[model samples]
Target chain A: MSDVRLSNGSPTLERTDPRLPEHPKPSACKSLFGPVDHEELKKDFNAHLRELEEAAAARWDFDFANDQPLANGRLQWELVEHSSVPDFYSRPPRENGVCSGNNNVDHNGNHHCDGMAQSEETSRADSQMECTEQSSGPRKRSACHDPSAQSKRSHTSPEEVSCPNLSHSAEHTPRKTRRLSALQCVQ
Target chain B: MEDQLLCCEVDSIRRAYQDVNLLNDRVLHTMLKAEENYLPSPNYFKCVQREIVPKMRKILATWMLEVCEEQKCEEEVFPLAMNYLDRFLSVEATRKTRLQLLGATCMFLASKMKETVPLTAEKLCIYTDNSVQPGELLQMELLVLNKLKWDLASVTPHDFIEHFLSKLKICPSTKQILRKHAQTFVALCATDVNFIASPPSMVAAGSVVAAVQGLYLKSQDVSLSSQNLTNFLSQVIRSDPDCLRSCQEQIESLLESSLRQAQQHGGPAESKRVDEEVDLSCTPTDVRDINI
Candidate 1:
């Protein structure tokens, strides 16, 4: 029976709108409060993202910013075949380019761009815009940007980690990022 | 291989058909247990937020609901977004000016979690009159994800409504109409601040009972009577009968007050249209009154 469609249509939402179903759909386009100060918002968001990355780094003991496993991290990073884990953890990036940059995180920590990385690069432009605009204080590049680690850490770029997607590696991000977290502490 | 794509259904928005496999007691019990983990702290304004007050939340919620309706978003997106908003506010002390930004970001995240074709950041910015930029929304979306620990699969009142309806013996048409009414009540509950921290299953039960009362549907079974159904649903959600009844009363009062308020602010024809929509009751005065 059609009963199984259960809350599938727009009828009920229309009923509950408190607007009379007509009258030009209420042009609720005006700002609810006032304009947000982009400067303060940018600063505050940068701090929050940095704090989250640090907290995750401490919790997991992996240098998420450098894409390198800490010597003392509680869990080991290993590389498993893509077929080993559920596809939920290894599916290719979706159209949104959410975790597209993390495809740089491969088995050998190599800096080379495979076909998948180039294809997914389209979505990372959103992240790039986010990075350049929000970094109020100079960007945090303690190890990744240090020229000393440049050759060895060529696998991860400062821009990729700064793109607000770093938190993806720490927790519930696109599954392909599981590669970055993949227990490959093969260093 | 390419022709197989043509054989599949394509639509602007995608939705999975309801799996009857999940409509069993096992799933219902699991949902009841999971709802508690996702509830917001009831007194976050007093204990956590220095600038945000409950009244402001009501305004934000009203705006979010309107946007969802305008976009024809899935029924679950608005409430799920509100859940994210409340959970974030519960732990963080946000400035009053940024509240709408937070609200918009919550919608952005929730729409992605629930919709096949989610709302765009640019459209959401336009909805806000461009007060908050898309970049800000994206940054806030990430902060919200971190604060909420990436748990977007929240159990909403919509989830519980399906399981409740499944146990009823009514025909598909009656079930369909009643589901619509219950869903309206659930959305109404989401907009009001009082229902904060109410377990989703209880809210769903109260809403189902209230819908049963408003429609005054008839069935041969003894349990469909308003009081019996309330008791039955309360048991199903594992709550006290008195608590469920009181919740039902709260929902009724909320509806009455919102309708009166809508009439005050809305046009004269507005109330009339609302009356025409609730057409199932036997008597206009009896059902339209909104009080038993």
Candidate 2:
């Protein structure tokens, strides 16, 4: 009773044996199918990663819609009747709005929605690639560089297209990232 | 010897299964950790939820699409704003402060986190119309973060809406509406801030389904074969029909305003202008759809 100690220099309740209670350890690599072929899945996973990267780079941003900062917390009817509803965003731009002539906001001090800053473009590209790779059909094609498909896809999904952990192996994304996905895209 | 004994006591306190704050209290701290299953103190919740809904409605109403139509704030910034608000109010600070200042601090913290090129203190002052001070906002941000243990990770209604949409094998058009509904619904939840304790995804799914139901789109019936999908969606929308109706009223008003603004600013000639823009980029296959 006088000589009990825990790890980290913390004291432990005195017992006959001070050694840490032993328990069965978990398997180092648990797979859906016992003893999974890591080599096969690894290659497949890598291909998916590359496809996502390429798709992201090729994605575009063409939304010309301008939404004012929400007054209070909701939209006002008066402003809605007077202002044009913004078109949704498209893909990453070749240039930022500051560099593009579209940077000129309306007389009403509206911020430019067409031109995404570089960092946003980068994140969008990353999200785009990830989104395309996650999908299985025609939408999966990287249409960012293909201006023809860009417009068609614009009516599809906006930034919500690039959700984290959307793939079969989505579970592999870090827990931290998955948790952040909870916030979605408010900020 | 005294230092060693003190260290042991501190270690024991840290190792205690129950919270240390539970000792000697009329109200238990355990109750503090209790699920905010109910709304916050009705007074504060009502203040933001009731006032902000109409205000957001006004903003949504007047927005438009244009060649040079400026982007409002980035979508990325919105979550941060919501997070700032949520984290700020999660504490017991409401006992000490008022709602207006709390709401202002949330905006300040969120603007800094979300905006790529954030607004300045002066701009924020103008934005909130001098409701709060930059110094106070900054101080509040730090205080809120500390209260939240700097755990900034948040799940928004948008994220849940996205996941819920993906669960269905729906068309892209439907998906788009779902996306809109999700955003709108999340914004709607802000009006009923008592639901803040619920995950954003759950709130988004719940609100979207409710919005869909209100719009006469029986999303639950969309997947009739999948009872799981139907039941899951049904539960979410069923909780508060009245809140859903109120949200729908807000959205309809906003949409009307947005369309009106588009018409006034966009003009009759705008249709042709957008058509030409669309024609310039639309592919050969899409040509038929464009005409139709």
Candidate 3:
């Protein structure tokens, strides 16, 4: 109901704040993650990464084991990188910004068409560069900021977003039935 | 623990059992044939729901116990009917013989796939007051499946409602209240066939609005504008005042009926359970069998 505006000034509200979740980098573990030793955190993270790699190799084996404590290691990292981890991880930053009185913007902002466009462009560029970035495996293709790269299609026109400056070119049009598989996350 | 693993395996096993495509195609063909044999009703397939089957129990007997039987069941049946209608219209010409029968058969097939224990054709016929013959039901079922060309991996509002409700950390009472509203939405769906084509998300939002409307109707203070419905659909489907009003009436009547039945059959303890309090913690927890 609140008529807050997106940074792009479009009239649709964003689902969540785009800022990434604060998963403390291993080296910076103590302050944000709370009292965790740096060495221990690094060791745990390395172990987690190893498990993820093992799981990746055995992806066929890990069906939805609803009752069991399945690692969800990939989903965990995907969520973290996507900033979809619970609010606890990101609540502090919002608290710090609460004094600005702009926090009310969270519930009621127009959709971010420009940011979506920018993010899409960045992701498409990343997709193009992905072949060369194979050495980094999964880490280098940071999806922390733009979750929609996989399916945030350019179905709408620039005119729809009121992007008058850009030319409406055929090449930029998103393919109608672009196949999106989970494995595309590697890109 | 083994049960959980079995449930996981059940998803894949259940996938194969889901022969809705075949079922839908067969049902549609039967419907077309039926229409060819009779005069078409103004309400199209919905006449099956309203006239052919006077009561919800007739269409869905014991299966109504679980969920999405009548109120939740209406929208479910509509889209299914639409899918059949769409396929039939695209391929074959329209007729008036047994269109309502066609719609009912699709609902019967869909209800079986949607619910675990589907009522038998005999039971369904018994419920419909012996108006439809067993052979006719079977014939329609096969025809609907054929018309659909066996492609029936359609979504339902129940699926979307489950997803959205899980995300919300509202109280159990609120959840029940929300579900009641959703029932209204399903009923409203009966008034119009177009809503059957809507995606699951739109249905969820519509159901939420319907629930809000139900609350408003009860409390007499809260009011919602047509703009809310417009915002929900993003102006996709214009709200039909008559249809919305009719759907609301059906939902209220259905709920009242359920309450009456529960009171008569569900002993004091069962009734108390209906009134029991559940926690409203906002934490995400797994709910079983979300698909409908």
TM-scores of the candidates in the order shown: 0.71, 0.35, 0.33
TM-score for chain B considered on its own, for each of the candidates: 0.88, 0.51, 0.48
Query: Over the stretch A64-110, how does candidate 1's per-residue lDDT look in tens digits?
Result: 55555456644333433445444544455454453223233221122
Error of 1 at B247 (Å): 0.6
Regions of model 3 farther than 4 Å from truth: A1-187, B1-90, B127-131, B167-169, B194-200, B217-292
lDDT measured at residue B9 in model 3 versus the true structure, 0 to 100: 48
lDDT of 1 at B42: 96
Better of 1 and 2 by TM-score: 1
Best by lDDT: 1
Error of 2 at B254 (Å): 14
The digit string of per-residue lDDT tens for model 2 on A46-76 reads 4533443344223333211211112242111
Local distance difference test scores for all models: 0.65, 0.36, 0.35
Off by over 4 Å in 2: A1-187, B1-71, B75-83, B94-98, B219-221, B224-230, B234-292
Q: Which residue pairs does candidate 1 place in steric collision? A: A77-A183, A77-A184, A77-A185, A78-A183, A78-A184
Model 2 DockQ reads 0.01
Report how closely model 3 matches the true complex, as a DockQ value: 0.01
